[model samples]
Target chain A: MTVLLDVRGLNVTIGGKPVCEQLDLTIEANQSWALLGRNGAGKTTLVHQLAGLRPVEAGRIRINGHDLTELSPKARAREIGVLLQHSSRGFGASVFETVLSGRHPHLSTMAWENAEDHAIAKRAIARLGLDALSERSLDTLSGGELRRVELARLLAQETSLCLLDEPMNHLDLAYQASSLDVLYQTYVAPSRAMLMVLHDPNLAYRACDHWLILLGDGHWRAGPRDSVADPALLSLTYGHPIERIDSTHGPVFMPRTSLEGAPDNHDAAD
Target chain B: MPTAQHKRILVLALFAGLVSLWLATSTGGTAIPATEVLTHLLSNDGSTHDEIVDRLRLPRALSAFAVGGLLALAGAFMQVLLRNPLGDPYILGISGGASAAVLGVMLLGLPAFWHTPGALVGALFSTLLVFGLSRGAGDWRSERLLLTGVVIAAGWSALISFVLSISPPVRLPGMLFWLMGDLGDADRPLLPLLLMSLGLAIGLLRARDLNLAARGLTQAASLGVNTARLRLELYFLGALLTAAAVATAGAVGFIGLIVPHMVRRLGGTDHRILLPAAALLGGALLVLADTAARSVISPMQLPVGVLTALLGVPTFLFLLHRRVRT
Candidate 1:
């Protein structure tokens, strides 16, 4: 399989704070990877770097063997579709128009709504079960529906690689399943791959073909799903007492919910 | 939902345009009979009525329409590009910059308004200041650009006030008159340049890149838009549009800011439709406003800017209320 993206010695710093340092990762075609991390673990930062939205403090990121640093943003977008951490504001646009914006990377500066663009956008909206709401305002949709619409927008981009930040956040169980299912069934097939930021271990275990768990202290591990085992590893990965058990739904991590409402104890995780 | 509503609003806008046209030409300082007005325009005889109809009122009326359309188009373009509802040439200090240059020429003992290259200098200086503060080659942001424009505009306004305070009394009335704004004293020779600038602005807007641009810079770039290059082009085009409008009518206020918003309310947010609709509606609105200003105090001309401000503030508030209520 061809490698779609390669990140080597990646380091990113924002506002004088180190977010990512000496991080190395690679994504191959036909692969599905779940990026698991706690809040403030640089997951969004990593995805942004891959999408070429952020400048690399130091390192190389290549998409489809083309060096990202060398490629223009427009060119990079043609290969990778990125869904932001949250839905955008100020648009007040309809679902169709929003989805149609995804085709902007493929069309020329003078081209209007050609048949091909509409066909692709329609397919994407159908995949998300948003046909009924295609003409509806995006603002009026539920959180889950909005996420699905945004996902449909990414699918309309028709890129080889998908970079999603917290794709499952704020989604109900049904929507979480449906959203990921649409992505996997339609886009992330044998030829393309996806890298998604996730919070729930069970969701990650169920949906991902590979796993990347970033520890709270900046270190991370990556490999096949089987490598994500070992309670000790998961505990250290989260910097807290995490209990991983085999449930009917597969692997579920039960963090010490006891820590909820507890006084600040930053060093205890060490 | 928005699409259907947008279609309906577009229809309403067309109707409004027709109504505005009739109202604007009818209610003016010298209310000539409709039949006589038409006869004067169509006739070749150099009659006094013909001169008043063709040479005086017609040019002024047309210029008002053109300037209004140009400013609104510019404002709409800026708002979309910057992704801010508040984005306009005046809000961002581009107008202040233009005013400052005009002020300099007016009070600094330069030759009369006839010698002032005020619009271009002012707009360019302000736009350059905005460009410098917002981003370098690779770091542009809408918020940053807006903030920088605000700061620059405030500073320039202060400088203008100081200069005005110290200038000789002889120059004071001209300065005040220029600042208050009027379409009645337009230089007919400048009309061609105004038309060219408006045409150029419309051309730049027709590019597919502008549609992507409305979606924010990162997304636009990702979609293959040359962000920096487009920004430079848009900034220049926006400045040109403002300069043309200022040159034509001497700082007519609020037409640029309000017309775009009003059009968006009726025509949806697609720049393709939005710009044209704004152009028509803006031109119509300003003409009507000017007519109202003249008629309300007949035989004595009102500063068109004062009427625009009075009408604009209330209309804008009503639009805001409608947006919220809807």
Candidate 2:
């Protein structure tokens, strides 16, 4: 399989807290990977480092055959599309205009959007079901709607590797399924790959074929979903009791939050 | 960011500007026929109106127009840079620096030619100081830049007052008039007009990138804009335009602060359209204000800055009220 993203010895630290030490990761084409961790696991920081927004402390990242740092900003943008967790807006423009801005890396600074560019933006908007809101101002949209707009922009970007930090933010169950389905369908080729940060293990299990978990304090595990999505490893990482139930559809991972999960353990009562 | 309706409004604004220029030239000091003003504008008829049209009224009116254009164009960029709808060309205290330097030069009994260059130097110095000092340990956020500029502006204001208080009484009248934005010595509009045109061109060329910049710098960078360069463009381009306008007529009020808001309120938010619309609207507003200033008290003019504020405040309020109502 062709490797799309190669990371070697990535030393990620934020505020003197080591996230991972000498982390090596390789994402091949046609793979969907989930980056799983609890809060403060440096998941966002790691994604940002990979997105080229944050500096990589001591590591090398290669996209396709070229060094990530050596690529021009425009070239890198064409290779890696990112969906950040939170977006800040100074002033609002229309949804269509916002989506069209996704094509910035493709055009020269002064070039106007041509027919093909507009068509791509339009298709993205349609895929994300944002056609009705295309002409509406951004400030007028709700949280869920805005997330869809951002997803549409990412779709319009059309990059080979998508680093999506919490792509499920503010999404309802219906949108979560439809949007991820659309995204996976669009990138279901040997030349494209996706890595997303998801909070729910079940969601990650369903959406991704591979799992990478941050165990905190410079430790991590990476492998196929079944190898790394172990109940004991997740319970240790989250500092809680977790139980994996073999459902009719698939195994579902759940935390032991209620009394029924351990009926005899009165010591764990809230 | 743009639509056909925007283009229609641009054409309408251009038409309004022409009529305003005519009104400014024809109705000051002495009432020349409006048709005669048009005739002289079209061709040199060598008539009696030639002295007023070619010499007296035309120069001053064009000076007001260009200064207005410079301020509003700079204002358009400032709003995006600071991410504030109320952002003004003078918000960073460029006018305060210019005023202090120009007043200092006048106090020393320097030749009139020194005022423009002195103002330019002082404005640039203030810009550099804010830029250099506000760049602390982290990102050069707008909040840091704005704070540094406002504080330095206060210092410049203090210096201006000290200069005014200690100036020989004989030079006080000229200093005061200039401070209140006099166009008496603005007989040459060539430089300011050129500066406004150049600024307008750059604003248009980078209009699309400006749309992204308006959203936020991080987002703009993610979209592949060289944000460091764009940030520099915002700072220096704004300072250059403002310094030129202030050099012509010392710190005209209301035009820089209000015209961009007015244009945006009128639905010219796209920088491609907003930049040019602001240039036209701002120019015409100042021309009419200057005309009213000279003619309202006839023979004794109120400061053009005072007239701009008095006229602009009500129009802006009305527009805002209309938006709220609808």
Clashing pairs in 2: none
- Report the TM-score of candidate 2, chain A only: 0.95
Any runs in candidate 1 off by more than 4 Å, and if so which?
A216-218, A259-270, B1-27, B33-43, B109-117, B124-158, B168-171, B189-210, B315-326
Residue pairs of candidate 1 with colliding backbone atoms = A74-B224
What value does the lDDT take at residue A259 in candidate 2?
Answer: 63
lDDT of 2 by residue, B76-174 (tens): 887787665545656577778878887878878788688778877787788778768877875566667767877988898888889989988887887
lDDT of each: 0.74, 0.83
lDDT (10s digit) by residue, model 1, range B1-326: 12466567666766766666555544566666665766776786897667777777777777777777777777876776776655678768887787778777766567545323677788888888887778665545665786788799899889888888998888677677666667766636356345645654554455456656766776666666777787776777778777777766666777767877766555366665566667777777877877776678788878788987786667656754654664
Candidate 2's C-alpha runs over 4 A off are A258-270, B45-48, B108-117, B128-152, B311-326
Candidate 2 chain B has its poorest 10 consecutive residues by lDDT at: B317-326
TM-score of chain A of each: 0.90, 0.95
Q: A53-121 in candidate 1: lDDT tens per residue?
A: 777789898888899978866678888888878675444667888888888777655566788888999
Clashes of 1: 1
Number of clashes recorded per candidate:
1, 0
